[model samples]
Target chain A: MRSPHPLRARPIVIGVAEACLRCVVCCAVETHFCHVQFEEGFDERYTYVYHCLSAPDPASNPGIWLCTACHKCEEACPYETSPLRFIEAAKAEAYKRGLAPRLLTGIIAQITSTGYLFPITPSTMRRRAELGLKPLTTEAAEELRQIALKTGLAEPRGEP
Target chain B: MRRYAFFPGCFIRVRLPHLEALSRRILGELGVKLVDVENFTCCPEAVSLSVDKMSWRVMAARNLSLAEELGLDILTLCNGCLYTLRTVNQELKGDEELRGRVNDALSIIDREFRGLIEVRHFAEILIENLEKLKAHVERPLEGLRIACHTGCHILSPPEIMGFDDPYDPVILDELVEALGAEAVDYDLKTLCCGWTLSTYGSREASERLLASKLNSMRRGGATAIAVICPQCFHQFDVGQASAARRLGVEYRLPVFYYLELLALAMGFSLDEVGYRYHRVRNREVERALEVAG
Candidate 1:
């Protein structure tokens, strides 16, 4: 979403009020919320706890707090705002400064290196076929290279 | 003689062949030729948004590239595909700097994305060709009340979707009305069905969102709902059953992809529209057919 007025971009910061909202929505599970605890001292301190929602699991369990960027919270909010976007921006900043999880970083590397998320292993193909499904993609892997060329986003690795 | 590249997206061929077949039939009835761009990868909408921003743009651009090869605007039936392609097109169109950065990062694929082709939702096409749509209706869907669910992708993003009034869009509604059925106005018509989010998280949230949507439609006196997204169709139709079971409420609402309803009104059969694939049994549609007959 390009801002018509890019110069009008104010940094999306999490204020004390926003943090308070995040805290209210936070459950005892330490899922997705602001970790900054308001200390009794003059300075704010960061509290550390494993946000259990970030743990890896099979994709089926429904209760996990994997934020899917659907922007529903943004729409559903009584305040008409989103805490998740702010958190995402902060995470992006952290990653820019090299402070994100190794697993996440590794996954990014794999996707960037290979044109797939999980490897398109034979087992995965067989599993898909078992479901009476064919690959949904219209472009084959080789044709994908040609498409990449046309888009000018990338050239096939061997091509000049 | 006009042919636009058809992007069936994930839901059409794989999950809902009914919509694909119906769309093809309906479009053919309207004299619009749809050319399939086969072998297209998953839009990667679920994985890319959280994983890496560049791949999301690049992957969508790849699809757009295929469409551009045909030298026609990309006509998308799936709202997710529309949103995904529109997002990439918007990024490349509005921000040359971002386009260059994404293109450079995706250099391994031997591709560069140029925002050349027009990315249009099927709703948009109907809006553009409303006269043709109206003329194609052989059997008017009389007495049926259709509530249009445009979903989030085609609306929102004021910059990307500059064509429609995001908050109060009426293109789909107008198209629905053109088919000789009264397009019933309903509350929460623009609300997200929360399906994209459903792929990774709680089924509860998606159900809750569906309940909210159905509640709005029921309150508004809609007999049926018209959907453009397959995921939205799955959620509103299939998800409604589960939602009713979980929430302990009866939701008799029948959901149809616009193409299916349009094709039906154009004198096509329920089987032709792939009615058997739907989770929700549509007795009201049968009732409407009897009334029209």
Candidate 2:
């Protein structure tokens, strides 16, 4: 499943190829420390280089999986390569291929169905009423549903 | 007094209405009129964008269109919402092709994102009117010590966010001090809140990261943690106990949304601001109010 957007399907790769080859900030935990530690014996540095070289091919690259989108690499890059943006584009590609994490997919479904990341449950309405806040109007929900349908994102796979 | 449309994103509306209520009260008192922008959806958070960028962009564009229809700039309470709306606003404004695509989808609902308005975080607005904010302080929070957590969305990708120096954000600290409190400096002040990773199956790493930050705040003698984002508030407030349990340490740091602190300093009572609703007991905040009275 390729990206519906022409620009997204083939993002304009920014910066020189040699710049990424010379820069090692994207993989260095010391340069931009991630909260998620790598598993034992998994050489983060080697894995990072492997992924960085596989640019525009997220399926083959492991760096996209390692990046936390912390934007540290972008900040730390002396050559202004914006490595994080490349990683993000790769993630977008992965998402198009139905490779997004389950937790994220669940969130997308909820947003599509309810117009909120979290469900506006009965108790939520009760709390809002108690606090004198108005409920989410039906008109707004319909607008969101239309947006989702037009984007072909949250449609119930087979049912239109 | 500048009037702006208020976009209270999902978290504050659903999980923490008190933050919204107190923000309205505080902003009103400061002479900034907050008009409710009805029928607003999620800023369609970055996480959602990662899953489906086009859908996220269209949803965000729709929200921006609502603000443009009212001919008012959006004032957001959540950092994530500010990031999403502002980034999308810039993207749509700069890319004619992308804007055309998004507008085409929006046309189905009789809406078009003209890219006419700007999006701002509530803290940015407060900082802009610091003189007025300081003038309205009836009871300065003189001796209170607070650690300001600006969170990642409002500060990162500095070119897009354009809020403060991302590396050393003092905007939140300045706001805290305006209320007569000491903005305690701590290490990891600029680190991610780890909320995103926590949700994505890195629970241990998230807890460890949070515990480290809490430990730093404790070392700095901060009585409470001040946050501008509801998500960060949840991490420090609701997630603190679990983090402490995981790390085998005690972290009793009470989390206060920046507006709550401002509301209190500007003469609103504890009950008026809904401090009791906080998960971790804000004994220090309670004591500060009692002493001020």
Candidate 3:
């Protein structure tokens, strides 16, 4: 079942995939064996990542792979390529194929429900008052919800 | 004195309001005028990017557009927000194709990212006015030993971040020293605070990473850890107790937001910077102030 979400359906650019094939710094860092893996000739890691990226079945790919979104790989890449962009694209594709982490889906659900990642409980409101910050107005919250709905990132409240 | 639109990202505003309050008070004292930009949303954070890059870019662009409309550069207090907004600004400015797509999406909300504004981390603003900052220090933190945590986002992807050398960042250290404190050098100075990993279901690895970094700071003789990012500050301050429990060692390292340290050097009282709210006691900071006197 393909996701009906707009962002889920967005195409992964071919250029980004080609760049990842050329430089697999992101995959190396995610595995945390960059030093040893590179010393033994990174060709093996590169081929493995290429297959994961080009794989037809998301389930066939290694489930151990995870990008912490640290962007260290992008920083460390000698070629100045943004390996993170490619990693993001791959993750988005995986998400569409129902292979992304379940925790991520929970986060999205929270955002959709509250228009914020975390709930603004009474204690939160009291804390804001103590710090001299004005409360998040109802209108502002509505505007945020509108943006989320317009972007197809979230559906209207109380709708499936 | 340049004017800037202050972007106090969600975590700082919601979880660490004291940091936000101190930043405003200290920046005003340091001759930077902070204009509050309203109707701003999240930088959408990096997690969103991994799940949906286009949506993340659009939301970030919306925030950037708010600053542009105000005709002031943005001053971000959180490193995560700094990375998201700055990277979006760079991408939109450099890539006409992506910008068009993002702008089209933004049009629904009646916003357009013209790419006219610059996104700056608070550390960059301090470094830019280092001399003036030094001149305003009435109470020098002379004997204080600080471990500076630049956090990952402020200096990473050096090409796009352009704030400092990613491998060996010294801007935060320099700022710490200018206030008459010793910025202690330690291993793992550039590692992530493990906050992201902790949230993403790698709790054990994250706790271990924090334990190692805190142990290093303690061994390096740091009295307190100075951070510009709230997430890193949380790891050392509120997260320290749990970390100590997990590692079976005591870590009493007090964490201070850069603004709190500066507020002290500029002669603000402990209550003024909300030091009492910190999870770890501010005894070391109090002692440093007493010794400086």
The candidate scoring highest on TM-score is 2
Per-residue lDDT tens digits for candidate 2, residues A1-160, read 8544322444443332345764455444452444443322225545343345455555334335545455666676667776656656766656656666665667877776666777777877777787777776435767888888898876443211
Best-fitting candidate, scored by lDDT: 2
| Model 1 C-alpha lDDT per residue in residues B45-79, reported as the tens digit of each score | 53333433555677777767767767778888877
Q: What docking grade does candidate 2 earn?
A: acceptable
Model 1 chain B lowest lDDT segment of ten: B44-53
Using DockQ as the measure, name the better of candidate 1 and candidate 3: 3
| Tens-digit per-residue lDDT, A1-160, candidate 1 | 6323211122443331233343233321111212121111112122211131221321111221244343433433445455445444444433433444454454444333443434455654554465444554322555444434454323222211
Worst ten in a row by lDDT for model 3 chain B: B196-205
Q: What is the DockQ of each candidate?
A: 0.11, 0.41, 0.26
Instruction: Give the local distance difference test score of model 3.
Output: 0.72
- What is the C-alpha lDDT profile of model 3 across B1-293, one tens digit per residue? 78999888878877777788788888888788999876666676776545667778887898889889989899889888998999899999999999999888888878899999999988887888899999989889998888898877777667788887766778899999999999998866766676765665355666766787888887888888999898889888877877777778777788889999898888888788898888886576688787775
Q: Residue A64, candidate 1: how far off, in angstroms?
A: 10
| Worst 10-residue lDDT window, candidate 3 chain A | A32-41
Task: List model 2 lDDT by residue over B35-107, tens digit each.
Answer: 9977888788785565467888999999999989999999999988988899899999999999999999999
